[model samples]
Target: MRTHSHPPGHPHDDAHVGHGHSHGHGTDARRLGIALGITATFMVVEVIGGLVSGSLALLSDAGHMASDVAALALSLFAVRLARRPATPERTYGFHRVEILAAFVNAAALLLLTLWILWEAYTRLAEPSEVQGGVTLAVAVAGLVANLVSAAVLHGGQRDSLNVRGAFLHVLGDLLGSVGAIVASLLVLGTGWTVADAAVSALIGLLILRSAWALLLDSLNVLLEGAPRGLDVRAVRTTLGGVPGVRGVHDLHVWAITAGQPVLTAHVEVAGGADSAEVLVRARQVLRERHGLRHVTLQPGAEGQPCEQREDLHT
Candidate 1:
């Protein structure tokens, strides 16, 4: 027998319905729009500059900027999509779209990194005479644009993985811009034009480093793994420690989207105790201590023979 009640302050309570999708949707969309516009405009400038200067580093920056444009646009679309109300057919609405977008952005960064590395190797082997003056001027401009874009996105990155993915793209562009500047100075000062490829290779390495973290995070989320920094065992211990909660079994916790965690568990209550109070305490404990809001708790008598008991560790 499942016994429970959603007391005041419970996230799943009636008064708080649909709050998940509505929170921060508009702000995220606006930030993404601004970032998209900036990335798209700079990408055009970089493309033309790369063609005119014949600088591999500049061309690579343009490529990274291009991906930034796509990532920002996709993030905006996802922010909008994630606002849809949950329905019978799609209970979670479009929450997972943000995760999917993050994954795509990370994958795009990896592919771009590989391409940049290959191009850098070829340029190094051939040692093209890149126009240092044009490279320097264009790189300075690209760096300024990327810095602005990064600032525009900085606020949202810490809170949302979707925003973080776009932010990472802009950071990659920023790295490319700095690389182009260094390479241009090297080529102009000492006539070592191979610096272009060397710096481009360095940019690829930096991007690969950041991209690997994002890819792993996205893959873990898609695999339904627990959110980073959340300890499931700790949560179980805390839940079990709730007054009248004899044991916590079948506890499961995972992120439905960035910052939105969902928890479901069967809480066993000691005999002759009010399971109602136990459920309330359990929910409150999770919310107050673990920062978990969307919780579905099933209360059962202690030592009850639950047939679905095998593999309960999850």
Candidate 2:
């Protein structure tokens, strides 16, 4: 017998797969809008400040802030798209759009960082005059703006990869602002204009670190990899241990998005065991022990060969 279980009101409904995530969509959209506004407003200021101060650190931070604006806007659009209801053709709705957005944002950040590093290297080779006093004043202002933007996105980032990508961009800008300030101080105190190029290079490296992590996480989701921290072998072992179950096979687990995991498996029942009872026990174990609410199971007598192709077995 083949059986499937999902939360009440949505049988085999991919739309309702992640119940925990539904409640936060509205709040997440609101937060993204707020952060987007803050980031867009400051990006212009940073650009003009970079030109006036002639500081590579300031220009690099301004470049990062520009990318932040684009990242925040994309993240906001993804969050809204993800809220759309599922369709017959697109059973999972637009949830994957958020993952795609994160991937794009991470790639853009990586490219921008490389550009900043290259510019910094050139500036270091041939030092440029930077107005320390002006750079200091503008960098301090940028620091304040980035702090507010980072604070706005921090709450939602833990729950959504889309939000986390935007948060990382804002956080990178925050660090860049700090680096610009430090470089400005070094130039003012010791007349070492090279400090600006050095600081810009450091900021680029920091951005590379955060962007790489976001890229890998979003890529994992896009590839339908198992949810992070979930152990497929452990899940198989636990399911096999269920009372009346003779064995487990052809088991599979993968995520639809960051927090939603779906599982399917074939279970062999012991001789003379009730298949219905075995199915119920298996469902209970997966739900209680593994926190899996979306599941499908096929149960048969121990001696029966699985009808599925052997190559499909994991």
Candidate 3:
């Protein structure tokens, strides 16, 4: 509606927040940063314990924790970077940095899962003696730590991808820790060291499931796909229904940052119209009806509208 001139070089996020101040995103980033620091410190403690305990489950859990530390660190870094103003060289600012980091964190976990499977395969070929009691204790401690980290991040992750990545990292650690504990009990009470490797393999399967989804989501963002939850058809219909708008085209929706969605489109009206007024109305509709803020629309198309060739192929 009303155009407020930002300081000339200020970076803008066309993602979820629209043209409003990025203060909310900044505040959320700070919270995730604090949670990550806490998570990283405890992760180190768990890794050392796993190594000393001589338990593969504990070690596996520690591996997961190690990844969690890396994920959290990336998220923390992303939050800070996302706040930096945009330059002509990088106009969108650093919002998508969080998404890139998310992809890295997830890919790292998937690679680690493959490594775990390979290790489990080797162990299956030649089973080793495990210190089950020690493994159990370490696993318990790791579980407690993971639970704490998950709790700290739970609130924000639903709204922020940086926090969600960190949360997923902690959740994966929790799964590994629990598997380690069960394997330790089976080994100590029933003399089933093979169960340890079996459990690790199962945990690897779970990680694969998670990693596939993360990779796909991250790739979608990189491809500039429409933001996950937005409906393009609905958006087009809504725009066309506007009083002064006869058609809408060239509409695009994508992430400018992890949790931000940006939209750009063209509107065509049948008669002469005011671009400013149409822009104002379009902005209002996106924000109020669609929960979208980062929208750029050019009004007035007297004749034919834009068409997506991809649609014709379908």
TM-score top scorer: 1
Per-prediction TM-score: 0.94, 0.92, 0.85
**How far is each candidate from the true structure, as Cα RMSD in Å?**
3.0, 3.3, 5.6
Estimate, for each residue in 216-244, the C-alpha lDDT of model 2 and write its tens digit.
99999999888888899999999999989
User: How does candidate 2 score on lDDT?
Assistant: 0.85
- For residues 70-135, what per-residue lDDT tens digits would candidate 3 score against the true structure? 778888788778778788998877778878887888888889899889888888888888888788
Q: How accurate is candidate 3 locally (lDDT)?
A: 0.74
Cα lDDT of model 1 overall?
0.86
lDDT of 1 by residue, 166-186 (tens): 999999999999999999999
Rank the models by TM-score, top first. Answer: 1, 2, 3
Whose lDDT is greatest here? 1
The TM-score between candidate 2 and the true structure equals 0.92
- Which portions of model 1 show Cα errors greater than 4 Å? 1-4, 8-21, 307-314
Better structure of 2 and 3 per TM-score: 2
Could you tally the backbone clashes for each prediction? 0, 0, 8
